[model samples]
Target: MTAEQRPPVRGYAKPVVVPERLDSLTGPTTGIVVLPRHLKWSGNSRYDLDQPGRIADLYRTVLNEAATSDDLSRYLDRATLLDLWSSMWLPVALRGKWEDRFPELRHRRYDPAA
Candidate 1:
């Protein structure tokens, strides 16, 4: 799917508090739009949720980093990590037509055992 076609990332549950006096003219605004912590894209200056590829890339990074880190095991067990790896493509899969563009994403099949 094209980046434009992707949906905006969900916002944080708590709105960011903008300081009342950034400048004399600017007033305090509640919930100023900001990127969701979970959805932040690596190497992206701006937040664009429409790109499923970004999510895929982020998952790839997470998997790679987790594999090399000893601390990851303390937070997540093997089963949980495996499940996360298996389902990493869910976002791109749900969008449809992404396989042609991103071959890295494997097609998830229904496995009775799973």
Candidate 2:
């Protein structure tokens, strides 16, 4: 197949930032919360939320205040993150089998001591 005839590969684009939506001053002084844009996926393409780009975006938007591992754990559960990783990054054929083998991926019990 010619280069042009081959299917085009999808790539990650920078997340759309809404300055107005972001809190100008974030910290103890300001109690404002900044919510991230919802993760959107292109139909059935290799592109999905599990990519580093998307993960970075998620951290930027949802977990911006997660300074420490403990803080991060409180903000978002590890299982949720793993689920996204499995669902979005894993090949379709492997998802069910992989999830079955690794049931722990379904939900991670939070342990602050750890």
Candidate 3:
């Protein structure tokens, strides 16, 4: 099949941001992420509904919790970032396998970090 006819392919990676600004942020920051237009169902629950993945949510939660705890050191580690990703994606993968088969999705790459 031609590229246009194929299903969409999307990707998302955690942003590498400095620890300074993650604190002192007042609200949910606007950011980009990849997600399928259709959500997959696993058992009785559903995966993300065309929204940010759990990884992004976890990143935000970590920032919020860290700010309160005054523990900026934790967010600096890439392994911690990856752990957040793993925690987020495992459910998606399982849902995809059983329900949607991990259909290719849409993606856009933002370079704010650059």
- Candidate 1, which ten residues in sequence have the lowest lDDT sum? 19-28
Q: What shift in Å separates residue 26 of candidate 2 from its native position after superposition?
A: 23
Q: Tens-digit lDDT track for model 2 on 1-114?
A: 332443543442332221221223132211222332232232221223444554434433343223333434433434444534433443222333323444554344344576
Cα lDDT tens digits for candidate 1, 4-54: 675554532322221122122121112222332343345542423245444
Ordered by TM-score, highest first, the candidates read 2, 1, 3
TM-score of each: 0.22, 0.23, 0.20
Q: Give the per-residue Cα lDDT of candidate 2 at 67.
A: 34
Off by over 4 Å in 1: 1-61, 90-114
Look at candidate 2 and give me any clashing residue pairs. none
- Give the runs in model 2 whose Cα sits over 4 Å from its true position: 1-60, 63-65, 86-114
- Give the per-residue lDDT of model 3 (tens digit) for 1-110: 33345454444232222334323333222333332222111232222323656445535444333323233343223443433433343332222321231122111112
- For model 1 the TM-score comes to 0.22
